[model samples]
Target: MKTERAISDEFMNALVDDQLDSDEKDYALREANQNTEFRERVCELRALKEMVQHAYPQVADAPPRTRGRTSLRLSHLQSLAACFMLLMIGGTSGWLAHDISSPASDNQMVHSLRALQQNDFGIHPSKYVVHVDTANPIRLKTALDEAENLLTTAQDTSQPSQVEIIANGPGLDLLRTGISPFAQRIALMQKKYPGLDFMACGQTIRKLKEQGIVVELLPHTQVTPSALEQIITRRLKQNWAYIKV
Candidate 1:
């Protein structure tokens, strides 16, 4: 919280990393405007951030893979994505990691603040990991509605990249080939949200197969070993909003 005139290199790094508070950010920008030297430093930091992001272009736009497929390798890509996110958030000390037996989310107030901020800028994506555990048409519709509402309400200037929808238990039916009433809707939403993930739980698929229930999923559905586990490690750890339906 040093005065803008005394802003240190640490402060400059935080600003470049998007970690400054609103008031401090304003102060730093004002300083940069008045001081040619500081402005040049700011520009250099911005260039560095952009360079790092561009270096990992493949990680961000890599093709979506099924979460449940045993042979499909996505852990490296997922980890790389998380690493890039940590760079943006400016830390490795806190937050959850993507893993089956990992812990829960942290700091509800922080989560709420982040959720509120997602509406303001696309600079740091407002992430979400929605749980669809029931095939009840009402519940499914609500989850879809909320997710669509998020995309619809995002700042007109930003393109989002961290939203995910995971289906497990009876909810896996929503992505099933023939029976889901939501199949068409899912397809349409996927088309609308390029980074949005529509996932199916592998455990559920296996159970259904054992029961002799025809278990074909939609063509683009990503399969993961366990939906809840996937959410905990991949989505929740990174501080994405978790919506359970």
Candidate 2:
């Protein structure tokens, strides 16, 4: 003989409603008799059916008010929660927009002042000076000639009352042994303008001697140890400006 399996709730319900075939109903009853839990569940279902039949009249008289109220309250709470979430999102988006749109706020006036200071018109003509420190001897001579021309033009126009030419560093070659190509022009400028000063760097002279180049003392030229410092000192103390070309 084969052992019977337990009856499921579906099988019990089918058997109770007379929906099962004879062979299936017999099998379900055999299983239900073997399993105590299944038998108990079937008995409870039968009792519930009888009570539901007796209570059908009372259930028809009442409406589902409690379920409807519960649903309404849940909808209201969900709407409130959704509104709060939207407000938070909107606030966060507003803050990000403000941060992105705002311009640089710190040191704005200071930056504007710095830009004004760098403007070309801030410096005056009398405060200007020129320093020539060229590497090539030919270029040095050419620059000297250009300076002389500029001085003559200034003197003719009387635009710049003060102009000085300080030649130092490698530019000392202009006053050294070999006769400069622009010697005649330089001599003429020196004779024409008494205020034009041509000075050489003493440091460059020492270096030139070490390199075995002879230094000849010239009449219109002067020498100094710290040429760059002297230029800076004159500019700052006497309101003289600088031109490097």
Candidate 3:
């Protein structure tokens, strides 16, 4: 018996573009509701479509040009502008179609390549900075889980992605020696992924010391003068994707 064909990117694209027929579209919609990966892919397609449309809108009722033909005399500037737009569209479409191929459980990054292409972080070994500013113990664990998910997803995409979590404000407790409830888990995670970083805030530590609170950093955790500054450094200096938790 022939293997049943899995729904493809083209089918998902059609659903996003509203090009599928009623019955087919209905089936695809149902699949999307059940399949998280399909749903995320549909969303990515819609977002890329909107980005392209916004960047290069076709003028209504404009006469189509034949190969190497123009109805009116073309200026050097207009020719250059047309060439640039064509290049941009070609680059973005090719990158998007090629880069995002994976299961939804591993592929949480649905960001447009255009966003990364603007910076220098378009390639593999992508650096991601997870920022945690809340004091909630649950949120810290959730952020770490999401970071690990993103790391695994990146690896599934065939690129080893780097991840670091920066915590400040009440979030600094995530890395504090005595007060953090999740210290043991953090230590275990560090042992598992030696490259992952859990950075504490020096500013917070100083404040806690002034209040007569002892601040001890867990092993494998680094201390930074400022969390926000480190985030800014990652964005501007290192081109790391910053996700706030």
Candidate 4:
């Protein structure tokens, strides 16, 4: 593999926020595809963004204190704080060998899920929420595969389990009526595992509708008012294991 070129953190932040212009976006996307480290950086940045957004849902609605510039600076500080927290948790380790032949569940997200389950103080590891926010085909498939594995393990061990797969942003495509590539597989999985559930973010649906797109979910898929709320409030706070794809 060719040595990956360095990308500035500021450029990465802009890329994640969709603020990159045509040429910059093209280069960023190309780098992300060809460079494993670059791709991981993008994924980590996105995870941090989501973590901050969910951790402080009211920040955007809060009134400015003295001046608009002050408010903006405060928001920037908050984001930096959240980014620091994520970095602390992720550690300053070098990239691990990522074998494409291995199951997608063998990635870092699944490692975190397993660690949480093993280190649970008192919370049982029966409830799991697999979060999907990207339209990437590999990740979408991994989300389903991971959910199925969790449900299957619980079933085989005779342990009660409730697994919910939540989709938002571009990942909402995974639950769309006609857009989902795994519609039939999803239906089959539902029939196979009664405790398994699928949820589509209502906010994402509304946004799509605002863009003049008709939003319809697959049969039996539920809609949550907000995906972040469902994850942070309904699941995480309730002690559910989280797996991000």
lDDT of 3 at 160: 68
Misplaced by over 4 Å in model 3 are 1-125, 155-158
Model 2 agreement with the true structure over 118-197: per-residue lDDT tens digits:
45554555544465655554357656765666677778888655556666555666655454445566667778876576
Would you give me the overall lDDT of model 3?
0.62
lDDT of 1 at 100: 29
| Every candidate's lDDT | 0.64, 0.52, 0.62, 0.72
* Model 4 lDDT tens row, 1-245: 11233388888888788776677877886887799998878877876676666456433545567674444334433433343234323432222222223233223333443344446685748988888888866679989999999999999999999999999889999999889999999999999999999999887888788789999899999999877667654575567876777
The per-prediction CA RMSD against the true structure, in angstroms, equals 18.1, 45.5, 16.9, 10.3
* 2 versus 3: better lDDT goes to: 3
TM-score of 1: 0.49
Tell me how many residue pairs clash in candidate 4: 0
Q: Spell out the clash pairs found in candidate 3.
A: none
What does candidate 3's lDDT look like per residue over 120-225, in tens digits?
6444447777877667655688788978888678767877667898887778888878888888878877776655888887877787787898888888888888
Give candidate 2's whole-model lDDT: 0.52
Best by lDDT: 4
